[model samples]
Target chain A: MDRNFPQELLETIQKADRAGAQAVIDAWAVGRPFHRVIPELLSPTLETFGRLWASGKDGVSLAEGYVAAKVAEDVLSRVLLDASGDGTPRPSSKGPVLVGNVEDDFHPLGRKMVAAFLRADGWEVHDLGVDVGPAQFVDRAEETGARVIGASAMMFTTAKNVAKLREEIDRRGLGNRVQLAVGGAVFKLRPELVAAFGGDGTAASALEASALFARLARRASEARGEVPA
Target chain B: MNSLERVLAALQNRSSDRPALLLNAGLYGARLTGAALKDHYRDPEVFAEGQIAVREAFQPDLLVSPFALAGLGAAFGSRLSESSRRPPNVAAFAADSAEAALRLPLPDVDSHPQVGYLRDSIRILAKRYAGEVPVIGLLASPLDLPPLIIGLEAWFDALLFQPETARALLDHLTPFFVALGRAMLHDGATALALTANLANRSILPAPVVERLGRPSLEQALAEIPGPVILHHGGCPLLPHLADFKGLPNTVGYVVDAGEDLAAARAALGPGPLLLGNLPGPTLGDLSPEDIGALCDRALSRRAADLQFILATCGADIPLDTPADRLEAIADRVHRAGRVEA
Candidate 1:
């Protein structure tokens, strides 16, 4: 809440004193939606860390950064898990969503991020994890009666798997039923490539992605007459 | 001018009769050395062998550190499958705990077996070469490192769901790198090379990179006392180039495959040396003469004022790629300037 907090965090990051920044995350982090945390706390913290890490300040190694990210994930998970344990009523008007890293695409960070955002935003989210083939993605989505399907690929070679997933979905006639969303480094490099693969939508950022899926789900619900738009 | 001296002169921005002959052998595969390096994982002999091979053959002006960034995720706690010939691939993380990542004490570079092997490699190379060649050490950036500790899925989830914590993790990770660079320099490394494949134009979005990946890279590059080479292995990566201007001591950049060398020369301005864009594997089994011609085309197209070196993207040089091919490249650089004369 102090005006100097973000500045101090930035300074600490510049000094490569991650404990100082972790102290900030400890202070400001609450089990809140990503949108709320991103603009104020998450955005500032990430912006500072990103800058400092690139600059090579105070001997920060990628291994150390990996440690810090794991730490942050623990803290966030704690908050979210605690809130869930409290049995407080979560808004449940939205339909379920299914997400997974596409086949041969071992990168799942993007998918995980979106799932977390959706969960915090009150959508029932299922993460199928990585190295999943196309049939599995659709099978899981269908079994869960999910309204949205989110897929991700971190590597360029594996991103091609998205097309296979799309083809299978069409062949199974699940294309119209499930709205497909894709994101990651591969999609970012080639924005137009997703359409050719038959993905319904793509998002550039986690926040944008969360919003995109929410909108898509709402549209799908409207088309099914399951809910008023 | 001799090959090494030509590179030196170009690095100093002095006029060179022609572009310096820069030879880079791309080293993937899982081999590493030493107990410190192999403590938690199977030490891929690739690290030691690559260093040895790169040193022996096509002794370039610089030795790019053995492939380590590809394995950072696994070192931090992800499971990785390795092969002798390919890059060690990491399976996604299951926990994705930001808190877990931050809890790790910064690894002392020499204490880590991998780092120890690396130190030994550099020491051996330096002691043997005696300043004849320079070694550029490699490491991952903050955004690049998260996926390893928490697994890719969980780390991404943290990025969206718990961004504050993710940023905190990056903040926590910075000092270890700074220490790593300092350690490498002390161990006889002449330059710091960040083979940030994640920063490739093909992977990370420009705005995201500018917002999250570049700043830390800039800070990291600044801390290295020797030259800094930012290896952007895939695509032009030009969109994010401007974010690098403030890096205090960067020596040059390893441009992506088939990038317009002239455009890269123009874009990078007159300051840094441009290393290469050899489409190593993508060119698909070309002759040494063919490879030499591509190198010539890249070097000659750039302005003489813009120092030029030659290299490949992130992949390792194929073993079948004959030594003569590399030699042919050297021969051409020597003869290239004379043709214009």
Candidate 2:
């Protein structure tokens, strides 16, 4: 991965320079596949933007994340469209994935990043956004037929809410069909929390999250004696 | 030595009977002292009575007000709602943008009812303790205040995009803090505990904290007459240790329990007192014996460091935390102090 493009994209996003950030992505994506562009270029760029914003560098804001997401979305949509060549009969064989911040936790940048990465990785993603309750996650998964649900909790206090979602899934007997995946600063600090809170797995970062969910989804399918699509 | 003497000795690097324990026994005060948490925060009389009762029962070195962090924002005209289980929180934010935030008026501390309630409670506790136990008043840090007035997303956005506006907002809020600090000191608060949750690496990076959060904090600390303890929730204070070192009159740094004490001690060096890393959030799950064991371990790890104090990393111990656990901590520290003495 050339660090130059990601570094430049991070600066542009931090400045809330959406046009410049988009241009950078567009320029880089020329004659390249999104699978290469996303994991290598766009995801790393967003991660840098997140780190810089977290660093509290001058002119960095939560809004920068919104801008970065927009740029990633623009590049992703164009690349996917180019690959499909007219968008007439493209079908997603990958099952839908549900992602959100646990109830009472409003920090959603990581979850948004995961949603974007999952989309780029050829999975259907339903982002429930921030402060999503346990019931909402289960209901959305049921509605969307999502095979995996990803919950991000930023604090130890709200991270406890993830357990509630776990219990609800168990009670619904959807534990086998729907796997619960958790991440965030708390999980990074305490990795054991993923299993302790009844989650099937945990990811350390956005890219890892998308990969973790793919593996979990495949394992679920294998358990049901079906070939992973 | 009494609790106050023990803490004072530790702060001055003088020999003490034992390590001073500043357990955040504030939230547990209501339940242990027979005052409802709601009444304890809403009524000055109940607040003082509850604190005194808890002090008598647990006998920790400091008495902290259990008032929610929303008081300052509420005083500045943000809507606050009181609850029975926990402290009041901002029901509504006052501003959404940097320009609007800068224009928000500075609240007169004297005119705010909640401020008066807290001040009265401080005076009552101070007079009751009468130089024995220090009554520390809780004030939201300048960095922590903006998110309360303007919603957190907006405040953080301003921090990333509009640096000057964020600083201006911090500057605007600093006087209110200075006034609040002065009033608390005047009313007998022996020290001021500023909750700077945003200064942690989990939220803001060190450089941004150094640039924006540190200056406003310095301004507020300069006006504060007594010792100022900055309590930041989250661990690995290594990043912000330098910024913490630069602040004036900061006698102690209260970091969360997950931090490596030895690393923090080495990073902080010998000047400032290292007050905590006791797992606060897990207090509800641990028995008194368990808590005592944890405290004993922490004390043993820093046994050679005289400036160490056993305290919680977070401000309020959970409301449901057992009184016995708090007592166990205090008793363990007392035994350690006596044995050392």
Candidate 3:
């Protein structure tokens, strides 16, 4: 399979032309497995756009990057439905995970990106939505029996409150049962913040987040003395 | 020469004893007073008192207004989250859609309590500091304000796909920018810090910004009584400096923390003062010596450029940023600047 998407599709997304991007995805995705299509095609496109957003290069805008992400998300959703009998996701090899922005952090862009990447990577993500409090995160994780909790905060002030997730998990005596994974622009800017804020781990980008979650998920399983999925 | 003079000298690209130092200590001022962060934000009197404490302690060249977006957002019916632990953030967008936002009324800066809260803070700080220091008034640029009014995603969709709808919102916000900014200047703010996030190249391509962002900024800056300082507003600035050049009343820019200060100064040319590249909220995590070293690096990067001010970049500095961290910065630059020992 060709690793590179058509340059036309790249240009289309850069123009924020949603229909053109969708059409490209429809064509390129033909005869491709959802797993291979996601890991090989979509993730690379996202990483490219993510670089554009990070570098602030001429002619590229975040609007264009947002278009690419939305297209990636759309293809994933459609693939899931086609694979499942009733839109219920086909059984995943991995455990479910929870993701949300910490309480008072209305910045949902980063968290939403993380959700899409996780979903694409085969994790059933229970997105708690923005402005989610610490209790809500732990409670949802407990109810879902999810082992890894990903919390996002864009600002340092909000990032400080990410610790509350750790505090809540410990208070419930789920310290060994549940693991905390944190991220956002702030964490990337200050790599030390992940450890300082009590996150068990962090990833640099949405694509990297899936790998980080996998590692933490393994640790949680081992602590619980369960066989790895 | 005092703080105000040092800032003025930097604005004019004139040589001074050293570069002007602006802490951009957004709400760390409130933290200095030991007031509940929420109370410090809520009560104008508390906010004023806090800035005074910040001033007494650090003697920064500029006093920035509080997160004016939260208060000014109320003009469009936006509400604030109630947080005792940290300063409150906007709990809800004023309008969920761009069309809904356009229908909202433009604020009367003289009477709107939310607008008045910001104006009063600047007034108090400006009045007290008087000729001693410059108070930078915060005014969200027309392109940037819509995201605060309507949510970011909705605004982005409107801006990219529905050009007319976004234009209408920009048209509506431009007047508010002018009015609030003029009022701040009237109240004694030496300059208006035009926080232009949407103007950043990363957010909108240069042509889009030229078509959508520049005209509103051109008009607003021309309308405001004081000179404007173009801030990165949480995004990088150096790449797009050309789009902002030659606007009326624009005196400088606040470089993004991740950007190279020397490059920003070079791109901006010798015309406008460049202030920034320090991460404001991360100051609390660093030692005084580290902060001083970063300050020294910023200074050396400029390498004798008189048109510069050392400042913390991004939307704000953390509230718990230790006083000693700030003092360390002041000891680095403020002590070396113009006439006073």
Q: Per-residue alpha-carbon lDDT of model 3 for B188-223, expressed as tens digits? A: 989888777786667775556778778867877788
Ranking by DockQ: 3, 2, 1
User: Model 1, A207-226: lDDT tens per residue?
Assistant: 35657888778777776677
In order, what is each prediction's RMSD in angstroms? 9.7, 4.6, 3.3
Cα deviation of A180 in candidate 2 (Å)?
1.7
- Candidates, ranked, lDDT: 3, 2, 1
Q: How do the residues B211-312 of candidate 1 rate in per-residue lDDT, one tens digit apiece?
A: 656676776666667777777754455555665644668878777677777777777887787777776543334677687778777766754543677677
Q: What is the TM-score of each candidate against the true structure?
A: 0.59, 0.83, 0.90
Task: Give candidate 3's TM-score.
Answer: 0.90
TM-score of 1: 0.59
* Model 3 chain B weakest lDDT span, ten residues long: B332-341
| Pairs that clash in candidate 2 | A55-B205, A59-B160, A60-B160, A61-B160, B17-B337, B18-B337, B257-B277
Chain B alone, TM-score of each model?
0.82, 0.93, 0.94
Most TM-score-accurate candidate: 3
Worst 10 residues of 3 chain A by lDDT: A84-93
Arrange candidates by TM-score, descending.
3, 2, 1
